[model samples]
Target: MKRYPTVLTIAGSDSGGGAGIQADLKTFAALGAYGTAAITALTAQNTQGVRAIHAVPAAFLREQLEAVFEDITIDAVKIGMINTVDVVEVIAGVLDRFQPPFVVFDPVMVATSGAKLILDETVGVLKTQLFPRATLITPNLDEARMLLKKPIESVDQMREAAEELIAQGCRAVLLKGGHLVAARLYDVLAVRGEATQVFESEYIASKNVHGTGCTLSSAIATYLALGHALTEAVSLAKAYVSGAIQAGKDITTGQGSGPLNHSYAPKPMQIRS
Candidate 1:
């Protein structure tokens, strides 16, 4: 029997099922890749906001990573919500050992509802250890601002931040523009020694965008696992997220922000070759 491309998500678990490991797995399955997860934290959250978070022990997190790596061939990895320094170190150690082909770091320092997810200490660990190992670091405006320790007010600022992140050892950076108060959504992809590419899309007016970032990163990882180039994967992932936002706009999953329609254009899994 042929084997399917497998994408793994190392992140927190959102009880709301809209973001984090839940959204990552949904995006992976929708994009025709098998999904696995190693949850770093369990959060009591909803569309409104996060109420509480319980982080898993670092040893257990390592065990989860080992269990998956020993059993399945992880084609790509999407890492999100490493809330503590120990958690970040543990994940970094696992990645160093396994060396997955495509490692996409979402750098989920902040949540959609404006909650701080990662601790200050973990930021240093992420930049020192995880950032250098990532194939691509996907950071939204707030996360970028925090990482670079500067305010990003415009697309120009986004470009500058991407360059700085690249200098910190990230192979590539996808600086997200969702938080920008502009009519056009612009995402900048910057790689070392290459001209940066900008992905522009019409900003869809939608409140159901809770997991948009997670879904997009996971989609990119899935496409990359299926052998798409970085630029192509990001372009397609942006389009997919835009469509998901549009599809889920009118639906209400909770009292506040809702989830994207991850399976809106779901395709049947192809026989692995």
Candidate 2:
């Protein structure tokens, strides 16, 4: 029997269908990887904002992980929207045991609409325990500031923040500059012992940007599962997201911020040779 790259996303469920596990699954399918998920929370959310969050029991979350690991060879894993320290601990435990080849962590601390998605105290554990295990951790300006306890308002600051995050023990950091007001968007990738690589794209103007961070991180995982180098995976993922945003830029979905066009141009499944 033929096999293919498989990716797992550990995140919350978004009823909006634009972000969280929904976006991760769409991104994985679009990028030619089999997708699996272990949802950590069930969020009452939509395009506008998150109303409430119901976190799954950490034991139940662990069970979900065991089920996937027992039968699937997860080539890569992308983590998002882990709302509590318990969930963080659960993820760290399973990952340490299985040790996937690539892990992309999008620290989903805040929502696109400025709602807080996690407890403030959980940030400390995430940095010390979770970030260090990731192949790359993608954080936008607000999330970066929250993690660093300061402001990051420019590309230069983003570069500095990326390095600082690396100092916290992560293998690499991808500081997203999407919130910086600029003609171009620059995402800084700082890997240990390697020169920083800046990935750029023309910033598309649109409200359909919800789930973009999740999408990018998941795409990175998918490409990594497909055997792309870390930098190449990041580059391809950014391009994929930019195209997805442009494809649905003018279209309207919900009354608030809508989702990216993840399936705008899908790729065929990749079969392992």
- On lDDT, the leading prediction is 2
State how far residue 120 of model 2 sits from its true place (Å): 1.5
Ten-residue region with minimum lDDT total, candidate 2: 148-157
Model 2 CA lDDT for position 247: 98
Q: Write the per-residue lDDT of candidate 1 for residues 84-119, one digit (tens) a residue.
A: 888888988889898899999999988888888888
TM-score of each: 0.98, 0.98
lDDT of 2: 0.93
lDDT of 2 by residue, 91-206 (tens): 99999999899899999999998988999789999998898899899999999898889888878888999999888898999999999888998999999999988888898999
Worst 10 residues of 1 by lDDT: 264-273
**Runs in model 2 lying further than 4 Å from the true structure:** none
lDDT (C-alpha, whole model) for all candidates: 0.92, 0.93
lDDT of 1: 0.92
As for candidate 1, its clashing pairs are none
